[model samples]
Target: MTSHNTFHKVVVLGGGYAGTLAANRLRTRDDVAVTLVNPRPEFVERIRLHQFAARTGDATINYRTLLGKGIELVVDSATRIDANTRTVRLASGRALEYDYVIYAVGSTGEPPASVPGAVEHAVSIAEFESARRLRARLDALPLDAPVTVVGGGLTGIETAAELVERGRAVTLVCGRALAPTFSASGRRYIATWLSRHGVSVLRPAAVSEVRQDAVVLADGGVRPSALTVWTAGFGVPDLAAASGLRTDALGRLLTDETLTSVDDDRIVAAGDAAAPSGQPLRMSGYAAGPLGARAADTVVSRIAGTEPAVIDLAFTGACVSLGRRAGIRQLARKDDTAVNLYIGGRMGAAIKEVTCRFVVAKRIRREADKPGSMSWPKGGPRPAGTVSPAETASSAGEVASP
Candidate 1:
C-alpha cells in the first residue's frame, strides 16, 4: 500500500463547465492545491456542440490558457471515489488523495435503449467524437436526404434548426410538445418558425425504434431517413454510485440547495451531475456556471469556518436559434422562467450568439483571475426579471416570419 500525504489538495473530477469554473475559483487561494482530472486535456464548449455537428463552429478550448495558473491538470478519467479515504481512483490505476473533492462529472447521452436500432444506427451529440461522426455522416449523405431528430428539448430543437439550415430534409420527433419548459407563446413561436423553414414537426408522438434508413413511431407509422440523431435525455457518470454517495435514479448526485452531498459535506456536486433540492432545473451552461462558482464559495467558507453565502441568481436571457439569422430571445427571471419581453429574428440570433460568447468569456475571465480573491463586480442595480408562470395561456395567431 502506498502512503499518501494528506496535503491541502482540492481534486476536481471532470473538467467540463462546473469543474473548470470551480478549479479556477479555488486556485486564487495560495493555501489550497488544485488538481483537475478529466479524460481529455482540452475543454469542450458543450453548449455549442450542435454548431460543431452542423460544421459551423469549433468546440475545443486550450487548457494551458483556460486553466488557472498553478492548477495541476490530470488527464485521466475518474472511475471511483472512496469518500471514506478521501481518494479518487483513476482508470490508469493511479489514486489521488484530496482534502476536498468537487464531483462535476457531467452527464452522458442516454443510450437509445427504448428505441430498437437507435443504439445501432442513430448518433448522439453528447461528446466530441460523437459530434464528429455525425458531421462526417452528414457530409457524406446526399444534401436532400431526410434526417430525423429525436427529442424536442433545447438540444433537439437546436440540432434540427442547424440541420435545416444545411438544406437537409429534417423531421423533428417530439414526444409531447416543443420546448415544454418555455412559455406557451414561446412554444408556438418556435413551432411556427420551424414550419416556415419547411421542417416537419411531429408532436404527441415518439420514435419507438430507429433503423438505418427509417424511424418507427409508436403509432405504427414510419419516417424514412438517412440519419437519425438522439438527444432525448442525459445520464450522469456512475463514479458516484461506485463510491457509495447518494444519487438519484438517473445517477445524478443528490444534493441540498447548498449543492453539498447529503452523505458527505466534504464532497460537493454541481452542474449536470447535480440534482438540487426541489424540482430539477433545466440543465444549461447558465445554471452550471453559477453553481460552480457557488460551490467554490461553499468550499472556501467551510475552510474559513464561516457560513456559506447564498448564491444570488440574475436573469440575463435565453436565446434559441432557428437558423443563422432567425431565433427566439426569451428574457427570463433569475430562476430561468420566461418573461413577457421577447425578441425574434436577426436580433434574437445576434443575442443568442452574444450569450454563447458571454459564457465562454466568463469562463476565460474567471480562469485568468486568482481564485477565492475574486468577487462580483461592484455597484450595479439589480436587473429586472420575473419567474415564468407554471402554465401560460397561448395567444394563437401566426406572427410575421423572420
Candidate 2:
C-alpha cells in the first residue's frame, strides 16, 4: 500500500473534463505521483459532441496536448474498485493501488431500457463512441431523411440545429417545454431560430417508443423519423456503488461539500459523477473544471495535513449553440436558476464557441501548464436542510467521522 507521508500516489479515473483537470491540478505537489486512467488515449470535448456527430467539428484532442508533465496516462477501463484495499481492478486484470482516488468517471448518454426500442434503435450524442456511431449513421442517410431529436435540453436542441445546418430534415420532440432550463425569453428566441431554420419543433410531445423508421408519440401519433437521437438525461457509471462507496440515487458518489467521499477521505468525487451533499451540479463542462480542481485540492490538502475547504464553485450561465451561426446564452443566478436576461443569435453563438474552446485549450490546458490556476465564481449558499455525508453515515451507523 502507498503511504501518504512519504509519497502520495493519486489515481484519477476517466479522462473527461473533470478527471483531466483533477489529474493536472494534482501537480501542485511534486511528491504526489498522479496516474490518469481512461479508456481512450485522447480527451473528448464533450461540449462539442453534438457538432461532432453532425460533422460540424471534431471533439477529440491528444492527451499529449492536455496532460501535464509526469502525469502517467493509463489507457484501460476500471472494472471495479476495492475500497477496503484501496485498489482499482481494470478490465485487463491489472490492479492499481493508490493512496487517493478521484472519482471523475463522468456521465453517459445510454437511453433507459424502460423506453421500449430506445436502447436499441435510438443513438446518443453524449459520449464519443455513441456520437461516432450517430455520425456514421447520419453519413449514410439521405440528405432529406427526417431525423428526430428527443429532449428539450441543450444537447437535443444543439443536435437538431446542427443536423438541419447539414441539410438534413430535423424535428425536435421536446417532451416538455423547449429549452426547459432557459428563461422564457431565451426559449422563445431559440424557438424562433429553429422555425426560421426549417426545423420542426414539437413540445409537450413525448416519445413513447423509438422505432427504426418512426417514433410513437405519447398521443399514439407516429412521426416518420429515419434517425432518432436521445438526449433526455445522463447517467453516471456505477463505479462508486460497485466499490461499496455511497452514492446518491443517480449513482453519483455522495460526497461532503469538499468533494470527499462519505466512505473514505482517500476517495474524492467530481464532475457529473459526484453528488455533493446529495445535490449534483449541472452536468456540463462548465461545472466539470471547477469540480475537478476542488477534488484535487481536497486530496492535496489531506497530503499536506490541512483541512480542505468546501466547494464554492458557482454557475454563471449556460450557452447552447444552434448550428454554427446562432445560439442562446441564458444567464442564471449563482444557484443555477434561470433569470430573464439572455443573449441570442450570432453574438450568442460566438460566445458559445469561445466558451467551448476556453474550456479545453485555455481552462484545462492552462491548468496543465500551471497547476491550481483554474478558478470559478464563488457559489451561492447551500440549500436549507442539506445533510453532510458524515452526518448521514453517522445516523445510519455506517461510518464514523475521522
Stretches off by above 4 angstroms in model 2 are 1-5, 383-402
lDDT string, candidate 1, 1-402, tens digits? 222343368899988877888888885556778899999988998878888999888898898867878789999999888888889999999999988888899878844676789889999988888888999999999989999999888788889999898888999999878987677788888999889887899998888889999999999998898999998877777888888876766667766656677678788777778765523345677667777777887787777788775445554546788778888887765545667667888888898888777766756455556555433322222223211211111111100000
After superposition, the stretches of candidate 1 with alpha carbons farther than 4 Å from their true spots are 1-7, 310-317, 370-402
lDDT of 2 by residue, 48-102 (tens): 8888898889899999999999899999999888888989999999999999999
**Clash-forming residue pairs, model 1:** 28-371
lDDT of each: 0.76, 0.86
Worst 10 residues of 2 by lDDT: 393-402
Provide TM-scores for the models.
0.88, 0.95
lDDT for position 80 in model 2: 86
TM-score winner: 2
Which clashing pairs does model 2 show?
none
Error of 2 at 260 (Å): 0.6
